[model samples]
Target: MTSKRVLVAYGTEHAATAGIAEQIGVTLHEDGLDAVVLPAVVLPADDVDDVRSYDGVVLGGALYAGHWRRKAKRCAERNADHLKHRPVWLFSSGPVDSSAEQHDIPPVRAVAQQMESLAAREHVTFGGSITSHTPGLIAKALVRHGKGGDFRNPERIQTWAHHISAELAALN
Candidate 1:
């Protein structure tokens, strides 16, 4: 049987969200799914392949000031028709602390609206990172203020990916 094709697309500022998306893609690929990871910015362009071609999609974005990145929002809006017909999951990457790992963080208002629009299966909030390497004056200031560290939990991310794989398996 042909493996299910899954798209893992994300929008990131300092690449933290991209790291999470790549980890999800790797987990899905290991579970026998054909996973393609890409930046949200490219998904909306004319030259890109249609979102309908994929059997499922995992869309994620970096959260800033309680809002998802613009590219991620635009990607969801542009592909709303196709995404609504498929199995879709949404995620947000933010919270520079352990809050996400400590508890279930609900999606922000905009993300929730997108989830409703796409009828997404689930939405997860993952902890973000702000390190010395993260560019931007704000990031530097945060780091200087001792609020910088990588908070993405690999085990949690893999578990979610496995859940997605199981769901897709059931669909087939």
Candidate 2:
């Protein structure tokens, strides 16, 4: 049988969310699925049409001030119709701490709305990263204040990717 094709798309400010998306893609591929990771900003203009080519999609964004990045939001909105017809999962990467690992962080208001509109199967929040290397004065200030670090949990991310793979396998 042909392996399922999964699109792992992410919107990131400093490549943190992209790292998460890449991990997910790698895990999915290891599980024998065909996974492609891409930045949301580079998604085709005819997203609805392009989205149809994938068996499933995992959409993620970097959160800033409790809002999803614009590219992620726009990608979800543009492909809403096709996404609703397929298995969809959404994620957000933010919180430069262990909060996400300690407990579930519900989707932000805008993301919640997108979840409903897209009928996404699930939503997950992963810890983000902020470091001195990250651009922006605010990021540097946060790092200087000892509030910045890479909090993404590889084990948790791999577990979730395996779960997604299991679910997709069941569909076939």
lDDT of each: 0.87, 0.87
In terms of lDDT, model 1 sits at: 0.87
Residue 55, candidate 2: Cα error in Å is 0.3
lDDT, residue 139, candidate 2: 98
lDDT of 1 by residue, 31-135 (tens): 988885432321322233468778998889999989998878888888898999999999999999999999999999999999999999999999999999999
Question: 40 in model 1: Cα distance from truth in Å?
Answer: 13
Which stretches of model 1 miss by more than 4 angstroms?
37-49
Report the alpha-carbon TM-score of model 2 versus the true structure. Answer: 0.93
Instruction: Tell me each candidate's TM-score.
Output: 0.93, 0.93
Give the runs in model 2 whose Cα sits over 4 Å from its true position: 37-49
Q: Candidate 1 — worst ten consecutive residues by lDDT sum?
A: 38-47
